[model samples]
Target: MISEKDFIAKSSTVTIDNGSFQWSAPSNIALVKYWGKRENTNSSNAISSEQIPANPSVSFTLNHCKTITKLAFAKKQDQSSFSFDLLFEGQPKEEFKPKIQKFLERIAVYCPYLKEYHFTIATENTFPHSSGIASSASGMAALAMNIMSLEKALYPEMTEDFFYQKASFLARLGSGSACRSVKGSVVVWGNNTSINGSSDLFGVEFPNTIHANFKNYQDTILLVDKGEKVVSSTVGHNLMHNHPFAEQRFEQAHQNLSKLKKVLENGDLQQFIQIVESEALTLHAMMMTSLPYFILMKPNTLEIINKIWKFRNETQTPVCFTLDAGANVHVLYPENVSETVLQFIQAELVGYCQNGNYICDQIGEGAINLSV
Candidate 1:
């Protein structure tokens, strides 16, 4: 079991030189969405600083929709505090600095070397900005990987498993979903009785034999609304604190994950569709029943969903949809049915998309160190 103290950096006499590292990490879509955080308490009933989820959630790590980051660091004479410059898509992005600054502060205890160097971080996304994809997940995971590369340079004997685990651990502090972006065709976050080696501290790859039917699953993201959400995910999660149905909802997530495991193992597409769609609706249902009671799904979002339902019922093509905390819909289907589904999407669903825009992606193998 990994503990919080394991992440703390020990003093080292080894001197490190200035260097640059680049990495790319992909965004992910949660099959069982993580909606709320635990009440900052550990097993011993003591206050804790770690990000712990109320329920375990699993996701498909996406290919193509990702963030690529380049981190260039130089040793500083005055190693008193953390210093960094942020750039987005080749231009200086001041608005993004605060988030990165907070991330650095959160992980500083784990990576003390940050204080000794000045960093220039340039990042860009494959998807459109504010397009409903979780850029924070990919961005933070990529940044964590680059930082891990720096750490590896300091301790060359680090094992691959430890390196990825620690990277996922640090990424979770930046964005909760980012822990899953560090690895995967499928990843699970939060501890559950059914899944071994799972922890709220980081995401673990789904550690069971997956049926071949799920291989190369297609995720066609329909751009229903290409604007920012009125309620950020963080705000939504906070609202769960006093939510009347929070407990029930959290329990439902665990049940759905258990069901999903069998579905994945048996290639039960019908069960998969039912659980995935119900989970998506349940996520929004929690939002609607929250104290503030806000909805993220737009009119076109409903329209697209209805169309998908009609198309599926009429043709039985095994295509279904899942949602993040946004208006966009992710149309998921097995690879074998890709041609027919793409035809249906283009012919029937394209009209509902914002500017007729959609992206084609699939499950991917986590992040890559481009500098390597």
Candidate 2:
């Protein structure tokens, strides 16, 4: 079997050689938010991912921890049969076998040449696995980007966009927003057109340019209630559609999208905070609008929000909070103030709640390939 030593070259930009490939994916933060989908194929695929900053979506794909993959093929029987084996950090993880199997099956249709041999793929996440940060998007992007590099190496005639498009679609199958994560700082998807919810409206259309410019902003996530998985981003999205406030929330989200884009273009931190906070409030509001509805905030979650608000009131800081379907509140504070903000939150959380833990985070660098 081919090994890392003899397989491929590595770099931040995409690369490939022989039948092997390695690449990276950057985690995306939705500025305008991409919630409530027109399609409900899966949880990650339920919504589009948008940008929230005014820095042209500058994400880092650092040289730190990252997922790398290599592909190889072996002849099985007389028919050139195929099977995938995965090694995580050196040891094998069977959990990814199914994900790999299905990924290979889907890719086969696009790259018929893939059926010619068996592929051995390896992957790893830079962050802790199963974290609530929707790590799958970037992880899948890394996987798909690596595979696309393999395809490009195997077929040099292919265009980069062609490879990326294939990867984007495959990434979508794995995680919806991931498709957009394939490129652009501020990517937008789903109800991309101004259809006004009319029947005449065409299907989804993602723009080719950066829709916003998010600056260097770090997200500090509190693990207050990282327990049993809350409703899937998919199920929650569907509930938003069928719920009575579906249309109204959509309208509000559309408006928020416009406002966020404007804030990004203008680079107004106060306006940025205004739009981000409003969108966060709207996301939670839609959740409560669902039947058999519930809220994900814990006592600590409220305390965090309260303290942030109080601190902001006292210091006139631009810190803001956004929640998904969990009790973990993602505090979006500017990078320049990350240290102070993180220290303040951690100290307060430890002092007031005494139970919740705060993990210091940065405007995570985008995806990157690793060597050694």
Candidate 3:
């Protein structure tokens, strides 16, 4: 049981030299979405419980859709505050700095070395902007990994387990889903009674044996609308505070996770598709029923989903769709049906995509240190 205080750094007289590190971290698609966060009762100590999820969520770590970040650090004379510059795709991204600055502030206590050096962070995503994939998850995870690399340089004795665990912990403070992006083909976040070693503070790889049918599952992302979402995930999460069905939705996530555990071990494609699709729809249903309701799905999103349903029913192909907090859809299926499912997507579903644009991705083994 790792507590928040355990993440805080102890006073050290270690001298740090300047170095650079590059890391690539993937974005994750949550089968069981983490829609809201647990409420913070202690206002003075809010940062400690900041990104804790309202319910446990599990996801598949993506391969092609990721963020590759290069972090260069140098010793600075002024140790008064943190210093850093951010670049996206070789250009200064001023708009992204504030978010990064806030994240640094949140984790400053955990990684105290941040204040001792100036950082130059350059990052770029594999997917295009407005692709409906959340970059924050990959971006933060990459940055956290680089920061951990720096910490490892300072303290040479850090174990690999502690290194990744602390990196996930720091990433969680940046974005809730970012923790899952740190590692694996499948990861579980938030504490659950059924899962051993699952923690609300960070993500853990699924402990049980996953059947061969689930290995290397495919996720073809259909870009329905290449435009900004009407509601941001942060705003949507906040809405759950006063939501009428908040408790029920949270409970449903827990129950679904338990059921999905069995489905994963037994290779039940039918039950897998059922639980996944239902969870996706239930996520949006919670939004629609909220106080200030808003629908993130577009008309073409529905068309694509209908096509998937029709094709799945007629062909008995194990294809299904899940959504993020946007109009785009993630078409998920097993690797065995790749050729048939992809052909179906091209013939039937591609027309609904924005300019016939979609990304073909699969399950991945999490972030990697490119510098190594």
Candidate 4:
């Protein structure tokens, strides 16, 4: 396991220069969701700048639906301040600047070149933003990949494992789920007794124990609402501070992770469906039961879920659903059942999606280094 301390040692020696790098990184759907954070005790339970979760999480990296980011670094004419031009889909997204700037500031210490160079970042997503898929996870991970690629160019001696570990660590600092985007098929983030090499700072690949059947699983995202959520994930996570069921929910997640690991290794689809659906419902339940309650799931979200249950019961297609922080439904199933499951989605579940739009995606082979 590469700890945070071990990962930062190579950053200081890198020499900065004009460089351009691009990477396409997939977004992940957390099978075991990460909802709340463990706050800094010295800060009165206030949310720390660090995005460490209260419980561990595991996820599947999705294909077809991903973010492609290109970053160009140049020596800053004015060394006094860091500067950058950020764009989304060839348009300026002023709303996203602050977040990106803050992320850059957070990682400046680990990659000193960030402070010395001006950056121009252009990013685009295959799927619509705020439609339940994690854009931040893919976006930040892609950006982190570009950063690490630049460092790798500066220091050719860096190992492939070192590049990914540092990139995951940097991505975690940007978005909690982003850390898991670096690993393929399945990735586990946060410390848990069920998996070795898992860390609170980054994610570890869950390849060894995973059954062959799960390697090619499909995820068809039913976009119930294309619009942004009423409450952001950050705000939702913060509400856990006063949540009555927070502690119990954390304990439940730990137990579920252990059981789910067994199911994953044994290829138990029945148990997989149960645990995945339970985690999705539990995630929304936490939100609804918060002190200031909020509901991200729409009427159609439940409608689609109920219909999936009906189809699965009738056909025994071995399909299941999981959700992120939004209303969309991620219908997960083995690739062997993809044809049947996708037909079921189009025939029954498509009506629930806004404009009947859904993304056909599957477990991807991690990120692609377009720079090479």
Candidate 5:
């Protein structure tokens, strides 16, 4: 629930005398499938003849987030500043340090002006650490926005949108989805492009209130096992290139996006469930088709899916499940049914999902502007 204006206030207050700034940001989830790609990791269309299916899967993000990146400078003889640290869940992640270093280099490139200022970034998650949620996306987006806000305070020549674009672009360097959180509510990440120069790797605002206003959407994440990190999406995509179903799957995802769009437009619960189930299977299908046949789903994954199916059959309720390149399963339902939904999951689906935790959140607001 970190307001955009509040984030900006922090950055604007920093100065050579003060020499430090602190800021925080929130993360978001994709509603329609951002599955396949065209050029430069842009989200592609589903493969159906109509380009999308009867419904587009909807995703809602919550205000729950990570925060407070403090950037300060250790002026090297008043010229060069050196050293940095990146903390996830508060322990020094030396592994991500080099990546942080690269980030510093890139940021300096954007505003060669900020080259003089050294930085100390301290970020933590209010939400679960790495329970299949992309804390970094939310984290970096906040940092990027704050940095730009700082620059504006230090240099009024920069436009307000300057920092947002800079931060949005910079977030891409950290994680692709991070780009989406740059703007909140019904944002389409990666190329809301047209035949003209209308879109690129950025957020696109949705106009309809129906897709933007639905309040019952709930996603309950079940962490199956937070063990070995899954292959990075970059590596996974490379594998996808070699995958037999890669091309076809891309097509299917495009169609699914269309169907998902329809569902959002019409709020068709049944269609939403069907398309989500298929999209999840299709996403994993690409991995299964890889040369090594990496099956990303687990027994618990099936257990959840099965119960969902059984629940639907027994009670004729509309509930669905989806997977994203890991053992974790994201269960979808309306907000009002969360209690009953989670109850059934705990009783019937809990056995399959041992050694994991559950987190509940619904769709949330679009990116906000901090008035620092």
Candidate 6:
């Protein structure tokens, strides 16, 4: 655990040379989604910040769908202000500058070097941005890892877990789900009795011994729409504040999380499918029930979902579909049935995808430090 003093600015005597660092972090799909949050400063488990969640969430980290970010730090002659040049896909993204700047300011307390040096960051995503894929999760997680890489270079004594946990904490401040992206296979965020070492501050790897079937579970993302959503995820999360069913939904998520833990451990794919699909639907349901109701899923999204159900029922294939607040559908199945599933996707689901675009991704071993 990092102490409060670690977040304080250091004396001028402490310094590190300019360096370049790169990291590729995966995007995570929450099975038991984290939709609502509340301030918990009075509680003992409360983090230093006010953005911690009210309940825990579990997720599966994807392998191929990720963001690669390179941070080139340079000692600036002018230390009076934070300086950085941001680029996305080899082009300057002026609109994204404000958000990136705000994230740097928020994390500057812990990573004091951020203010001391100018950071030139170049980021690229494997999947399209603003689609169903969690670009924020991958993007923020990659940036957090880059920050931690610089810190570790300056302080070589930092342990591996400390670096990762701190990165996860920092990522959460940028995007809540990004915390879970730091851990691979399965990770749980938010404090819960079902998971040991789990906290509201940052996510922890799923403690239970996961079955082999789940270890290599596949998630083929069927992209129904490549365009941006009408309502941003930030807006969707905010609607939960006064949502009529917020309390009950939170309670239901907790219950599903508890049950899913057992399913994960026992390889109960049938029950797992039920819970995963329900959670995906419930996530959309929450958005629809909000004050200004809106729908993100398109007609093709439903068609693919129905096709998946039909194929699964006819073949008894342990396959299911989940969504990520967008028009895309995530076709989940075990690797053993990958042949049949991939064929099904090509034959039926491909027609529904936008421009015949879809991503073939699976559970990966967390983020990669490409800097090394």
Q: How many backbone overlaps does candidate 5 show? A: 38
lDDT of 3 by residue, 1-372 (tens): 677777777766667668899999999999998999885443345677688799999999999999999999999999999999999999999999999999998998788889889999999999996776779999999999999998888888788898888999999999999999997789999888888889888999999999999999999999989888789999999999999999999999999999988898999999999999999999999999998999999999999989999999999999999998888899999999999999999999899988999999999999999997
- State each model's CA lDDT, in order: 0.91, 0.56, 0.91, 0.85, 0.59, 0.86
Of 2 and 6, the candidate ranking higher by TM-score: 6
The C-alpha RMSD of each candidate to the native structure, in angstroms, is 1.5, 8.5, 1.3, 2.5, 7.1, 2.2
The positional error of residue 88 in candidate 5, measured at the CA in angstroms, is 4.0
- Give lDDT tens digits, candidate 1, residues 205-229: 9999999989999999999888888
User: Any runs in candidate 1 off by more than 4 Å, and if so which?
Assistant: 43-48
The list of candidate 4 runs beyond 4 A from truth reads 1-3, 9-16, 40-49, 130-132
Candidate 1, residue 151: CA error in Å?
A: 0.9
Would you give me the overall lDDT of model 1? 0.91
Question: What local lDDT score does residue 165 receive in model 2, on the 0 to 100 scale?
Answer: 53
The candidate 2 region of ten consecutive residues with least summed lDDT is: 50-59
Q: Give the 10-residue window scoring lowest on summed lDDT in candidate 1.
A: 39-48
True-structure lDDT of candidate 3? 0.91
TM-score ranking, best first: 3, 1, 6, 4, 5, 2
Clashing pairs in model 3? none
Worst 10 residues of 3 by lDDT: 39-48
Deviation of model 1 at 324, angstroms: 0.4
Model 4 C-alpha lDDT versus the unseen true structure = 0.85
What ranges in model 6 sit over 4 Å off? 1-14, 43-50, 130-132
lDDT of 2 by residue, 286-326 (tens): 77778767676678878878888898899887788776556
Query: Cα lDDT for residue 23, model 5?
Result: 59
